[model samples]
Target chain A: MYAKEKTGGELSVGGPSVRGMTNAIVVERLVKRFGATTALDGVDLTVAEGSVLGLLGPNGAGKTTVVRVLATLLVADGGRVEVAGLDVGRHADQVRAAIGLTGQYAAVDEYLTGFENLEMVGRLYRLGKRESRKRAGELLERFDLIDAANRPAKTYSGGMRRRLDIAASLINRPRVLFLDEPTTGLDPRSRLAMWEFIAELADGGTTILLTTQYLEEADRLADRMVVIDRGRVIARGTSDELKAQVGGQRLEFTVTDAAVLPRMVERLRPLGVDDPVVDEQARRLSLPVSGGAEVLAEALRLLDGDTSRIFDVGLRRPDLDDVFLALTGRAAEEVASDDDTTAEPAMTGGAR
Target chain B: MSSLAATLSDSVVITKRNLIKVKRVPDLIVFATLSPIMFVLLFRYVFGGAIGGLPPGVSYAEFLLPGIFAQTIVLGSTTTGASIAEDLQKGLIDRFRSLPMARSAVLVGRTVADLGLNAISIVVMGLTGLVVGWRINSSVGEAVTGFLVLLLFAYAVSWLMALVGLLVRTPEVVNNASFIVIFPLTFVANTFVPLESFPSVLRTFAEWNPVSAVVQAARDLFGNTSPLAPVPDAWSLQHPVLYTLIWVVLILAVFVPLSVRGYGRAAGR
Candidate 1:
């Protein structure tokens, strides 16, 4: 199936018959509970046909559970999931054919070479022998793995293996792709490379649903984002909208000397700097400001003589981490180590 | 018409992938191939003289070859369970479960690949037996039929192993479980010696044993005289063909559905 090129930016791929309902994924009041603990409670989400929706949460926020249900790998205890306009429970085979899944860890066969792995997946999707090999070759080139295609997967680096895994999932040219924590343990460079590839896929009109703990990744790639905690949707909005909910900007300044911290705080007080706190050890003064960059410039002028000697001075806006803390009542960093953090933001569900 | 043809075509592709896996892992082939040859040699050379009561004009190698044929097929089938368990441990099966391919094709393809390996092992063991003075007096068709019977028995055993592989959570547990049951069953049958040599009560059980039937059928088809040929009871006399076919059908009836059910349960569907 192929789409005709249009003047508009939308790059549709599949036939018109498959695009009747433009929503790629729809979950209404989705709830999944593992024994006594509820992993997903009343989670509602809708992904557009050709956009990337990032499901952002800390560990145990049911990101994996949601993906599993959508992929038809695990059945949800309650609520309904629809993929590619087919009911996941009733038409699981249809749903599976329409969606591709790349789990958190690489799932390529270690014994097989990169090319062989892709070819195997291609055959499994029922492509003819010649067509399977052609598709595998194209994927290998696109993923920048052609050179290492003949090497066994076990010999590849972590990044190469992850790339191979993603390539394998796309053998069928699925309409919807699910990536669960795709870059959890990847190096920064490889993570960025993967993000670019994901963005490229979205650009080519593939609906993508991804889960990640990294807020920056969500901000960069997701068209719409949802913050989940303790198996519930705590916040959902565009990046700017979520940041707006957690009001004000951060104004940070570091004095040249430890003794000058008090003076710097006093000089910047009239510039609408609130809650000024001094760290004697690092000789830094930080405060919240309601105004934007202009206020920061004015504050710098007030300390004109010491501006050059200031260790650091900047106005920072609120990010998803702030929204997470404000909504969940705990910093995202603190919750990273707690597995039950997704079960209950409060201290109810004990350590797993 | 086209869609049905496409499905069949896809199944062949899936089957080829499994064959590639079998080829890549030469160690599995080596184990399946060498184990049978070694068993045939050990039984014919080391233990043949120790056991008596072979009919005149029948060398121990001739009598031992058919039993070794059955033994080799059974041993090769155990790898089906081991491979499945290993795949489960490595999360390969879980990955396959998420894919859109035919569900039944996955396990069936694995069994088919294992059956091919079993055939190779059977041929290797047969050649080794010939080198050791074992003669097959039967025609080419009879000899081929003997090998087919052994292969059918191996196919049935593979299904049982597939069920065990799916039910058990760990590879080590599958190994221990299959070995504990298979080793004793092989020993008590006529794999090493004729059933008449056992205690009278044990002889009755061995006569009805599926393993004994397989060995007896192979021995009769290959024209190798067995010590139990003198038994005149209709049930015992008919053991050569009927019992082997019965066991094959029975195993297929039980294990094919058992494995599919186990897969559903393991997937938490």
Candidate 2:
């Protein structure tokens, strides 16, 4: 059966089972609903034991719902899910023991100190008192929160609090770690720092399933991605594969003046392989082309003598953004921004 | 270890986490104490003379101290609802669920920690009652029993609050809604006035109310009962301890499991 190829033999490594197991997470035809709303609709996903599977979707698309279900925090109405080789529905405690989850918002207790939060998590994991304290100290140091360890979590900045939250999840060094928009509200620098920390964990062979609206995050850390919209998987592939599906390259340029855009478009259209798209605000125009470099160079040659100056010019292949647009029929960022306005601003239903 | 052992240990850990919050954020406890003190001072000086139908020869403060103890603890239990709702909003309950700990730990810990806060409020209010001429005329043994009954009843009600807290979305909603429910419960009883003063139909409901039974039980135990206090013909007031214990058992039997179920749903969602 297909299940035989997925669940592997027992663990050999000490932390995270390293490369021993083949599938850390698997969901088939999963279904969930809240009142009249079906939050998850027959979705399937599989993450090899040590790889990262990014659950890429807009907010309220039920990415958190799927994560919650896999983490044994939600009961699926239909189908089967196994995490760390244990059935999520039947062996929920075992599944919970094998996984760690850092939610969309940091879930650390604000009244507890950073050290206290980690230690409490460890103690709940059944680590003895001494060991719990030891692990708490180690994790705080690893997260670079040692200095603030004695202060309540409420005193930490957003990024510091997020780090402490992630550290609490790792107190037991779970085999499968789920991060729900781990960098949602951070500055660009903190986002990069978080990416590096997540990458380091991935390098240690910890399986990760992350949901994100930031395409750049998926592109940066995910080995494979499943794009879901409105509780359904619309596309799934490696970043490049998704990009390639919405195929072809575009010749793009920004002219000095908005009025000269039509002239530039006219010059590049004939050399173009397909229709051109213009940006009035950016004073930019792009044309799909068959010949890679040759067409780009040829387009520049034709526009060389034009009176209007060119601020920027380049030939570009599609990224995950284009793939998301092609599959969802909407921009990823737009759907994400819509969430900020439409959904409850804080963690609520489906957070678990 | 066994499942029960694990649950107990997990509960202790979570209880410690909650107790730490009380220590760090003193406002909830402060308000818990302050409100009861306000009630004592108001009832003793302001309302004491205006409240007619009180029996002669007994000071209002002496007649009313036991009722205050019972009422304070019940109102104080709302802290359970507020604190639990705050945890639900903060997503900390979800975090606890993700661990391998006992599913019952979060609810158990919350009620227990709130019990501690209730105990503190009771002590502070007791001291305030003393300063205001409220005295325990009975022996230490009976007073101890009185306080135990009060704490047990409050603990049971705290579980009911736990269920509400888990069912609600925010601490503010829990605070507001619980007051709407708890106010009538405490006020309609023999807490602020004598049973004879209540209209006949309302008097029946007030006498039988679990809040009244506990208050009556505490009044008898503390030797605080006087001619000024309500003397009802109902069996509930005649056997206040037994009646209060029945309510305690009844509330526990229903709300304990319901709160646990609600907690599971809260975490999963």
Candidate 3:
């Protein structure tokens, strides 16, 4: 029912339907545990054919676990998962055939050249020898790796390796693709480049399930967002919907004197829906409010003739960061940094 | 394509990938060949005089050559375990697992490629043996059989190493752990010396040790065995070729399924 409801909004035009299916990937109440630790508990999501669902969470929040299970690399402790209309548990081989996974770390063999890596994957996918080579060449060209196609993957830069990895996953033209942190450690330029590639893939109508810590990446690429934390879906919506859920806009003011903060909050209190946040030490007041420019005008009128006490004033709409803070009670970067010291080393091969 | 044919084709793909690594990283093949050559030179010139239990017609070089072949291929098989562990650590196994190919392809491909390496090592060791005065005394067929038996045993051992690789799941640990078991398994056998010289307990081990059987089979086929030498009492050595084939079969039977199962369950940490 949910799958039917979600389809046809922005499904790509004339996308190939390999299995003549609607929902490309679906999971119902998935449960997974590692010994006493529960990595994923009762998680559920779906990706419509030719749509992207961004799985957002902090590190160790079971994002990778979900991807692994859907990719048929790990068996779930309980619940049902299907990719391309085939159950992962009973028809793992079929599921593998329909789905491709690019893991958190680049999984290319460093010893093999880029062309050779793609060709090998293609052959394994049961493409005939000539077809496999042809597909490899096509992918290398598309990924802009044709120049270095004959060079070993070890010599490629971080971005190039990531591109090659994604290219290898695409060799079989899988119906569903799982990308776990595709641009995790890339530079800004490379991240932008990867984003463009992902956008192009999205435009081509490939069904994708992307797990990422960068909210900007998810916001830019994912049509829908599912936020998970500690093995549970805490929130799910489009970028604009999630932002709106955190409330409309904020009226913020910074004053030269800490003593003026409370005065500012009192003046704007009636205009805001909730309590205005006052920080004496920072000498600032931030209040949530509805109406657009008129509210700013009214707030300015309320503080008219008291402008000498205010250093700055502005009306700001909530970004995904605010929504994340409101929902998770921790900044994204804080959780990411905390996770780095505690998470297990990913064991990236030669291309550091 | 049918399932079996698909599996075979996938296996060939993986095998080619592994062979490319062998060519790209010369160190892997170099060490595999160099170590056996070192063993040949060490036993031939340095310890050949100190150990004097050889039969009259059999030179120490001839007697030691078969043992060195057994040691070379058996130890060379560890490459399977080490490379498997490396793949697991590097997340390549995870990538392969996610693919639609046969689950057993990774193990089959690895052992097959390692078998090729074992063949190369054997050839190099053979040439080194000739330079050191070791000669084949039997007909060409027997010598060819000797080579086949050695390769078969190495192929079997590669599966055992693959299981070890999956169990340990790290290249450095696989290297260290394999040696702890393999060193004594090779040395306690008749690899470096005549079985008659070993202590009773060690001699019994050597007589039944697959490594010793392989060495004895090679010696018999290479025409290096001497009539004047004291015959081994153990039935395994008395019928060395049969004993060696049985071990190869048994090792393969036990390790192939175990390795494949372990590989399927190995989730890259």
Candidate 4:
């Protein structure tokens, strides 16, 4: 209840306040098993106050399980979990009070009006009637649901329902917020709106712990990220740091003629093109290089400076996807075996 | 506010949510209301006046009303399991689990909501009984006591069903399982005819049956003095009340823990 207040306009991005650097969530060696399957295996994570920590992992990689344990919904068999300095097991109610959780799916009651849903959550947090109504109104307006506030949630669109669900979790203004794949099924535009809303919450000094399969989402919003694989924390750092760990950029190009492949390869051999691979059918050439832009320019110069006929040329830094693949030995989308619904939807689109 | 107040507030919110759900799907309430009414009408007209050897002044309406009361509560209580199973299947229970409300509020709210719906159906059926010449001859206090007993029975039964719902993975399984288990239990009792009219072994069991005791207690309170003249000893009539009480306590004792344990397992899953 004594969370620090944010200072500045909505768009004014500022660093986290250093005075309240206390950890909002602390999970150490947490392990949970469902019968024979180990859902979480010695996972350790800490979320600092006012910072957004993204838990990036493939499906079935225990991201949701970790959130559940920290939220006091599921008990860990082998480790300690604390929220806002309260132990999750011993002080579950306090932990619950201190944290808000938005699961993968929107969990608001479809039958209740949006206003009723917010009011219900407020009352559950023990707010007085007037206070609950005021808070509900504030949330409705914040989520842009004020006009449809009186309508049953069943009538709301997918994005509207998601916003309502997120609003419901904020009824008590929890110190820590856990969003588990919050933007999974939303459309691109809706996902961006939800991301902005989450960014605003973080800017408002709420410690947010988000789990998402979208690499771009993690890259965009996470101040720091932890990549988990097979129930273990495989990598942890800021997005750039993790990407740096996976090594240099990738250089890709498409030549106009397949007959020029050998000559181009020979010309670019001196530019430190390691493991150059050519697709004759697509007339594409790809190679990993240390300095992306410099290497591309040099390779172009070596090709007789004929850049006009080049079909495609690009340089890309190592993305979260590459980092994930490098650490886990498999693509994120491929690891989600249980959910046949491909991760492509979340990847190709926005965070949706 | 006190902890009890906090718990009550949480339960009230959940109850409000469930009530909204019932409102959205009006068919649920419609079916709940019509089922008991149809049962009363069908039993009163089709089976009444043909059970032969009725007491001198006893009408079929008077004889069947008590049994129908028990029948209605028992039937209505099964919805507890069905609704919970549906919620679980739809991830509604999982959503509730993620909330910061009291843990017991989820099941308690559901049972309470079902009890409210059951009471409405019971009252409607009672009116139908009155229209057919059946009446409560007892004092207001006795009538209230009888109603409380029926409600308590329904609550306990709902908790038992809630446990079943929690344990089962699928809604269809829960629906089929509860009905399968409850139908024979309700039918074997003296709901349709007196135990004396049954075969010798069944008659003996039915005399000791708790359903029979509930019917007899309702009859005694309603001033429908037994025409058999030589009613079984006072202990036999009192056994139903005692048996039903024991059942209520036993169910709470077993199912409350079962429900919690089932919830714990589900959360782990």
Candidate 5:
């Protein structure tokens, strides 16, 4: 029943380079519910082989639910889901063999030494005794944990535990990796280190499905992104395409005085897609515009002599944060505060 | 390797992981060994001469030894539940579940590792019992059989606790919940006292209680029972070995599948 391909009729959403690649993960009309609350509603997504697909959403948007389903940790209520070309429901063990999962919480056993943790995970992955030890040593060195390999994980810092967790996930050298908010609680320095590590993994041709609320992380790592909100897909595209969907670029000018704002707005009016927004207190004027650098040039030409009043002018492209807000109608920071009230241990916390 | 062989290997790996914690955590060693010795000392000195209903030629200390063995082993089984709940709370179970291993390995590994702890506790308690006035009058084979029965009953109880752990999914709650059920289950039976002294209604319940049967079986195997004592009229107490084995088999049959299924759907909450 799982051998037949169901991807034949689906439209390709990625670039030509991604078109020829087989999908490592495929989810069609997925549905998951907890009691009366629908966690995922008819969600559809695919991650091409050796490519990173960012599953972007707010705290409760079911991003973790999608990852859990693909990782074979949670069974979907209604869907045709496949990972590594194996049905998640029927061939869950085969799917697990091909996938690696690093949950939000560092799942390392605190009492075990770092080496023991990795070696245990390797053995569970069916790596033989000698091979498990060898792999544990290799992963500890690779994750820069060799110095602390014999220390219990309870003594390690949060970042070290997270690294150990990720290293344990790579015990089998999984083809598809699911990292659900891998850097959620790390400090800025540790977050940067995690990003570098993830980049290295992505470069090694591992298909990654990364779920994160950090838009900057997605913008940097993902080849394509599927944005979900309130258990449904709201947008799906590359970073630039999603940005473009949020009304293109903005032309902004920091003026010498608030008086020149109206004149500047009139001059840049022809180039903008919408009416100009003027701020009197800050002496700033912004116009939503299209056509990129040429539009800035056109605006500057229209303001030939009036340029003296404008101290700074540039075209600003919409960022993922803006796209997130425009799509979800809630800022990422607000969604984080909302998550604290409904926290459950295993469901939406880390495992799911 | 075949699938069954793979499951056995996987279970051994997980069992090793759990045993490592026992060596590292000082608190666990204290709880496993010290508490049983404390119980024996408290009962032997504090209440040993106070309660007396034993028949001729049988010492209260000898009778209390098998009861202590049963109680300690049963209480020791709670560690399995607490550890499992702790794993679930910290998301370690999620990591294990996502791996390409046998589904039953986690529970099997936990119960088996805990069985090791119970063995260590028995050795400690056995030495402590000898220091008081407890002695095994039976042959070596019968004594070893007595110890085996204690461990087997504890193993079955571990599966029952595993289901509780998966249901509650918190170490603290599992501790409290198991205490509520296990306290009366062990106390109201023949564990700490003879079933003959109980009021007629309580005596009937004690005679059939699984803990009483297990304690009675241990006493019979160790030759702690005196011929002058009243013979149990209840069939379960009369054939204590068979009754205990039946309960062990019945508990394993009901709880093993319940726990595995509960674990699979635990993340759903």
Candidate 6:
């Protein structure tokens, strides 16, 4: 409650233009290995002050590893990491004071009441008794957890537990916050509530670095995004820029005959921006194209030999799911199984 | 001095949080009390005539009191290790690690809370022992010293468990590991039987075991020692009080630093 909020110098949620401000998080050539597996390999990233950078990747993508290193929870095997200008490994205590971390799982004390959890974190932050209670009360009210404030956190729903987790992180009003998959296992309703709450924090000028296998989560929350797969940064840009990487919309059509797929591909090549991807098993062919409806019109005119033979055809913009598949050649959900899914999303590199 | 104050203050805050966990869930307190109640009833009625009857010049219940105290308090230390491991698995340790507080606060707080919990169980068991005709023949000062020594030794054992808890994979592993080690460590000594009743090699082990020294020391202080209280064959049994104190200090010296240092690297759990 005592934390101050600044005005002006605010950028829109989607715009990630960081021309002048100092970066809150600077990570360069970071590497972390577990036994024989490398979790992070030569990864580099910078998040501007008062901006949100979403670390995006599939399972075994090293997103959570990067978060742990920046939060000072784990030591990096190599490279450098600094949070709010303090080196995480060297000035850990100071970096700890400046930042709040909501790990991949909700880290709130389940045995303690929601109010007690926030108050305890406040005391850990060295806030005096009265100030701690006051801040805890304010946060509980702000997170809409005042109704269940006195109940043990274990009794709260998944969404409430996550809200309390985030509220605890804000106890010290940290300059930067690390949220690793803040909405990983939540129902859609709770996940949306969490997204709005996080959006509010960023709007208030707190710098944030969040990691998620949910591409849409990163797309909605992060101003600048970096995609890491197999412990390497494969792509980095704004949400729009990352979307642009896959290039416009995809045009897909299903041919009635599986035998005619190759012939259809040759006829569609001239209309496509890139070579069409053929799924012979599904009798489907999809090509990336710059134009939307016009590309479809030309494709139908070009492949008019057997218009009746086409079962399905459509043109649509590439969503995050398509981006993930395009970049990593696998769906995001495929990387996370029920066992290791809710835990660390990206711990293993090569195998399940 | 300021650093000392900071460490103490941070430890106090952490201790308060840990204690609150017990308070919020009074089931933990009830569970802690239940085990001591079970032990007292079982040892008094079931194994009383045989194991409890070996010592001379005192009733089996009275003679068995010191051994019970030593065993109960030592087993209580296992809770310390298990609780720390549980905290690690639950991500509470990660939360504490990310805080700008003293590095040793979490472990210190956990051990102190476990110590407090152990003391409660001791009092509960002491009352149960009294109901079964166990008496303190010694003066109040000596009785206090006896209980204090048992607590100190238990606290030392807790540090060892704390280190084990940090290095292990899970809280369940800590429970299993403590049972494997503590059961043999406490049972192989003169905890349940008199040294003279054991075979030759077993008698020597019973005479020199630190658990035996702790029990013998408590019995001497409580004025419930057998006629052969001195156990002159072994130096440890001869000076039970001094030997137990030496073991206490030695374990504390080795384990406190190891647990604290291990906390940093133990996050994989």
For model 6 the local lDDT of residue B121 reads 86
Candidate 4 regions off by >4 Å?
A1-20, A251-272, A276-321, A340-343, A346-352, B53-56, B90-95, B98-100, B200-209, B229-238, B260-269
RMSD of each: 7.3, 5.3, 5.8, 6.0, 6.2, 6.1
Error of model 5, residue A266, in angstroms: 15
lDDT of 3: 0.85
TM-score, each model?
A: 0.81, 0.90, 0.87, 0.86, 0.87, 0.88
lDDT score for residue A268 of model 6: 84
lDDT of 6 by residue, B141-249 (tens): 9999999999999999999998988878488899888989888888888776777677898778778889999998898899886674445578998899999999999
Off by over 4 Å in 2: A1-21, A248-260, A279-284, A289-319, A333-352, B227-231, B267-269
Error (Å) of candidate 4 at residue A93 is 1.2
Angstrom error of the Cα, residue B37, model 1: value is 2.4
lDDT of 2: 0.83
What is the TM-score of candidate 3? 0.87
Which residue runs of candidate 3 sit more than 4 Å off their true CA positions?
Answer: A1-21, A247-324, A330-352
Question: Candidate 2 residues B1-269, lDDT tens each?
Answer: 99999999999998899999889988968877898999999998988877766656566887688778888899888888888888888888889888888889988988898888888988998999999998888999999999999999999999999988888867899889988888898899988888888899999999899999998898889887765644569999999999999999999999999999888878623
Q: What CAPRI grade goes to candidate 3?
A: medium
Residue B166 lDDT (model 1): 79
lDDT of candidate 2 over A1-352, digit per residue (tens): 1222222212221123343546678777889998899999988777888889888887678899999999888899997788998898899988888889999889989999999999999999998899999999998999899999999999999999999999999988899999998988787678888999999999999999998875668888998888888888887777776667677777777777889888888777788777888989978787878766777678878887674478877777665456666787776657663554223232211111
lDDT per prediction? Answer: 0.78, 0.83, 0.85, 0.77, 0.85, 0.82
Instruction: For all candidates, state DockQ relative to the true structure.
Output: 0.40, 0.78, 0.72, 0.48, 0.69, 0.74
Tens-digit lDDT track for model 1 on A233-332? 8776666666776666778776677888877888888875466767788787767787667887788788877765677777766555566667887767
Q: Tell me the deviation in Å of residue B176 in model 1.
A: 2.7
Candidate 3 vs candidate 5, DockQ winner: 3
After superposition, candidate 5 runs with Cα above 4 Å error: A1-10, A13-18, A247-321, A333-352
For residues B145-169, write the lDDT of model 1, one tens digit per residue. 9889999999999999988887775
DockQ for candidate 6, please give it.
0.74
